[model samples]
Target: MAAPATATILSDEEKAVFAELRNEHEKHRSVMIKMDRYYEGVQRLEHIGLAVPPELRRFETVVNLPRIAVDEVERRLDVKSLMLPDDQIANEDLRVGWEYNDLDAQAPQAHKEAMIFGRSFVTVGSNEEDPDQPLMTVESPRHMSVKIDNRRRQMTAALRQYIDPERKTDSATLYLPNTTIWLTRDNGSRWNVTDRDDHNIGRVPVVMFLNRQRTGSWFGTSEMHDVLPLTDAIARSLTNLQIAAETHSVPQKYVLGMTKGDFVDKNGDPIPVWESYFSGIWAHANKDAKVGQFSPSDLKNFHDTVNHYMALAAAITGLPVRYMGQQTVNPAAEGAIRADEARLVKNTERKQVSFGASWGWSMSLRERFRTGEFPRNGRIRLEWYDAGTPTMAQRSDSIQKLSGGTPILSREGAWDELGWSEARKARERQYFLAQESDPYFQRIQEKEELNDPSILRDPVQEPDHA
Candidate 1:
């Protein structure tokens, strides 16, 4: 459910911003409702056919077609790629920020939320210790109120406060980093008239990481909105199709214009009637009646319609038709499978770009939180795990190519490409250096580096040119 339009009655100035936010909230909520309907698989319940008398439905069978709530698009697009720390780690300020979040464990969950909702909002704040790393947090957009500098496309001010479900009073207040004491004075009672207050956690510490943003909107767009129509149409079609089968299984029975007494006994009492009786005998000298055939066309039509709509849905979403469990003839070859995934790969790359920028800035803000002063210029960037996530062989091949190039890639560069953690790389480096210094292994190292068989010959013996 969306928060009430008049969730808060702000002063004249704040009113404008609140109005905009309320508008956004309503749209987001509307999208959410449609998405919920798709997931529940009940979109067809309303479209099923109904007889004039509801009671007639019992005798005439009604079928409900299967609901194909295929959700591969979201899954394929949202696979969590590791967010690696970038060169900015070389700077003391940024290094701390990278480690503070303990992103190794936290990233999978964060990525999942952002992908599911099409966006995730983050805030920067202090950690227990260290300036190198600042604490970054993800806040729910539902509880947030943000003011944007449209031209700058940045958040100018932010507020997050929750009201009591029962008393309706502001039960909790989370002061935005930007809601300074000065701004609070202007907001008046709306700002400080809270039962609870949070002291300064340092400037308004909120930012948005849009999941594939839509045109002319601050909120991220969800994939759910795109597929909602298809899901609804398919579900409705399925229900009607299934119901048609049962209804037609027993076609309309007919009796000749025989007397009404044919249904009654001579005592004038109504003869026992089995309405569902598909077969019976009416003995007469001039008999001429036969059971009507139930043509299989109706059921076939419904089945075909369901498949056609499902194919259309697949087309609209760019989801592979094979994923719908409709690929029945033959298993696809590796090349075909890769081609099918090409569009999804491109989609994921786009997400990486948008989300990567947001995460980078969030880390920068965290570094600033650690040190009261913001670093003038710094290298702070997210290390995105490979979206394609190549197998071991692919990674190794790429690593070799990169390292063997002109102006060879640094050891650090190779390690990063290999997705090695700093700790693991450090251990490997230490072991490498130790081996180089060992006299016992010096001959082996020399021969390995030289790649000459002559080194294996005895020092006193002459090498034979066999």
Candidate 2:
């Protein structure tokens, strides 16, 4: 309920941090422009279609074909299957609160959109009137700044900027160490000196969403960067494709040779070489008069080149070649389909691990909202769906083997491992438990557990049940 980071003045060091942050923010804005262009399928003719040559314009009109945007495919392919899919937030009370905050529906969508900009943040705090349900909202990095301690070991302060449309002014909130507002500035200049103290993480109340982070760096890179060069290449290919189509479709004209004597006499009389020399429809009195037909050769070459680049884009961005919509092939085997997406699956898993931490931190912040405590715990984790899944077989052999091999593993856990939905798993678990509840099945299961040597191994430690 209390405001943090409200102050009228800033220290010299704090001013320096703001100066550096503003500079870095400019770079982020530039990158976002490029990323947005690709994400929205707005690959431009800005560079490739600029100037037109006079000769080519005479033969075939150049047309801009649909831009083959690799950015959205790459970004989506990386995050689409990266759903946390975890039961971590299945707490009954928190479920209501998550829905109350609209985070249940929007979290996944916001996370993907944030990845496009390379970073996002979630601000978790509470309103005085609604103390029971803490408020949490996702924030774009463009509107926020965070300053960490010199060692980079801890973040001590944060600032949020807002532009008031009605007032047509910029306002800033500089929050500090004690969950207190250190500074409040209204309608300030861009170069205005920026306005930190808290080790209490909850007091900061901002959790950063950073994924696909490169080593030795704090910033994350989007898939747009991975295939940025390919966007131009793909655009060039499509443009050439249009040129080829136009060239092959347009008419070509030529003339056949005839006797020159028919052109004129020695008296300088104007004469036509043929009955209709320039008539467009040629006719000759003493020679052949026909329009020559032109066959456009090697038109396939243009399309072939385009297809090659599209393939390259697919490979670089981990998008399936089928997404290019070029050729038709028979349905692929399950293994082959999985192979095509192997790179994508790996990328998605990496995102899950990275964003999992961020989500877990957000959950922690959500708790901080409910309780006045800065943090409930230092350790947190999120469960993620398995990579390379959506198997054709709902109940796999490996799942059966797992159940038979580990008596300690719950039936529901085994089902979940096979990528079964919670609802399906619940139904299957109930059916199995009902069947196994009989004395006969229970006696058989006991005998099997007793026969397992791993369970009898000298003082075997209890394995953690999934």
Candidate topping TM-score: 2
| Candidate 1 lDDT, 211-300, residue by residue in tens | 667776776765555555555556555555556656765465555545545555446565556632432324422245443444443476
Q: Against the hidden reference, what TM-scores do the models get?
A: 0.63, 0.68
**lDDT at residue 447 of model 1 (Cα atoms):** 71
Candidate 2 TM-score versus the reference: 0.68
Looking at model 1, report the run of 10 residues with the lowest lDDT sum. Answer: 61-70
Model 1 lDDT, residue 122, Cα: 76
lDDT of each: 0.52, 0.58
- What's the number of clashes in each of the models? 12, 15
Q: What is candidate 2's CA lDDT for residue 175?
A: 53
Quote the lDDT for 273 in model 1: 61
User: Which whole-number lDDT from 0 to 100 does residue 305 have in model 1?
Assistant: 69
Candidate 1, residue 95: the lDDT equals 41
